[model samples]
Target: MLFLKSNKKEKHFFKKNSMSKKSYEEQAEVLSRAIDIAVEAFKKFRPKDFTDVHLAHFVSVYEGYKNDILNPNYKFRTLSALADAKNDILIYFQEGSGPDVNFFWKRIAEEKIGYQRVNKMAKILKRKRIANRMEMDFVTDCLVAYRQEGLISDEESIMLDKMIFDFQKKGK
Candidate 1:
């Protein structure tokens, strides 16, 4: 009778716990899928052109999640982090094609406003080996300031949100 009672209790406990036991492999698979979706969305939805400052914002977001989603023990931020990451990656890739391909930079130069400072900051970003949070934060701050100065457009902001969703779906 005791053996039968103990077996019943064990079965109940097992049933209760079974739903939560996600294997590491399963988690990794999910993360990979999430990244794929994000990458696709970035490729599809990103503007054909963007400014260096916009690209910096997109990169900051991506760097945040590239660390968070891959590690099993890492605390998850809200879905916004993922969006930020995707947008950042998209912008970064777009900017790498040079100034001729990016109209925003040309506009800045034509206007003769904030062009020199932006160029200087871009050089700093390129030269600095951003291996730590401090360097990353500095870049982010500069980018934010550029945005505040009306350098990046509302269309760019919308693209950032799209990239976040793309990353979140992929990271899932």
Candidate 2:
């Protein structure tokens, strides 16, 4: 006859086994709790401050580039330039028409600014025989992918929803 392990050792093994068998939901909850603690600790250590204009510009540029990314026909070079140009315009909008005022205005005007930019890009694609239906389909797919990937937070998700609704309304 073999001697059995002590109750304490058996209890320890059972605890380890039970922990390893946690369901996906239980694992997710544990991971989320850890993340929450980490975030709180980091927030306490290092806070961040951004200007309102910068925040607005960031949101605008992010949304703009995200829209561009959804376009199947969107050229990478064009997207990069558009993003750079938007940044420059934000600088100009904040810095008050510097020495390169004309250049800044040209970029901003060419890019069409805010909501108009989306419509302009869509029209350009449509004129080139990229069907409106296809573009809308691409946008919807991108939105779904973005949500699934957790790229957009709840507030951002609401914004995207509104943007999609607005786009659909305008398309009709």
Candidate 3:
């Protein structure tokens, strides 16, 4: 019958699409892999022993997710990597004692960094904010903050300073 034929076709389509999402066990495996990747990156930073562990964990997780966050269609791998880093960091911070204890609340001075914030900064630059001293100062402060946070090297900071100065002087 025509009805039976349609049902058979529907079942075939369903089976083909059944593997789109992974199982819980598979998700766990992916997350575990992400944690390992994050830890390796963290070790490279060689954070100071007196550095705030919570901040370190947050920074590590941010570093792990940085590239992925820029993607509009964030893949499963990205989600898993972020989740993995957060989980491991949480566990590590929960220890709450030893040399890391007193270092817990202390934080390295740094300005806030976020995806939207970065985009806004770029937009601001594209604007004619260089007409005034305040705007120039704002950009300079941001560059300095970035340097302090190790996001930009001192040389890069100096270069940007000169570039901004040139832009302001040009008055365009």
Candidate 4:
């Protein structure tokens, strides 16, 4: 009993004396930065709608940050940080930011088929789909990606050329 008590006292003494370790402020900063990186990784795909795929992507990115980006000592549920970031991702999903959906719809619109024809198609799809999440993703992505700069000229081709230009280029 005496020996066990001595060992417990020594363990407590070391734990209490180890006050020079990383501070709470530093841990919080690192966690915030890790979450930021995780979100950016998912953004690379430009998924307009949040689906099972986006959730998987977010989980992979979060794990990457937790295991590789953070110190090995940090252990917590990845969902903890994700709970906060999920709202931001949901906004993008609501805005219809996916890759191929919008472009396809706009192509059909720009072609011989007019908006009425497309609305008819949407109605048909609405009857088939309970929630039109995928359909909406397609329409919204097209509007923002194609129509944002200005109206699409009837003379222009319907082909979507996804130019891989860097908007965040260096140098002022």
- Work out how many backbone clashes candidate 1 has: 8
lDDT of 4 at 41: 38
Q: How does each model score on TM-score?
A: 0.28, 0.22, 0.27, 0.23
Task: List candidate 2 stretches off by more than 4 Å.
Answer: 1-135
Better of 3 and 4 by lDDT: 3
For each candidate, what is the lDDT? 0.45, 0.44, 0.46, 0.42
- Candidate 2 CA-lDDT value: 0.44
lDDT for each residue of candidate 4 in 50-78, tens digit (9 for 90 to 100): 68787687667666554542443444323
What are the per-model numbers of colliding residue pairs? Answer: 8, 0, 0, 5
TM-score of 1: 0.28
Best by lDDT: 3
User: Per-residue lDDT for 161 in model 1?
Assistant: 43
> Model 1: residues >4 Å from true position, as ranges?
1-11, 14-18, 23-28, 40-45, 74-172
Tens-digit lDDT track of model 2 for 1-172: 4437568887898887666444323433432332233233233333234355645555465445444433324244243444454443343233222233334344445544321123322342335422366555555655565566665567665655665676677774
Task: Output the better candidate (2/3) by TM-score.
Answer: 3
Q: How many collisions between residues are there in candidate 3? A: 0
Best-first order by TM-score? 1, 3, 4, 2
Q: Which RMSD values do the candidates have, in order?
A: 17.0, 20.2, 13.1, 18.3
Candidate number achieving the greatest TM-score relative to the actual structure: 1
Clashing pairs in 2: none
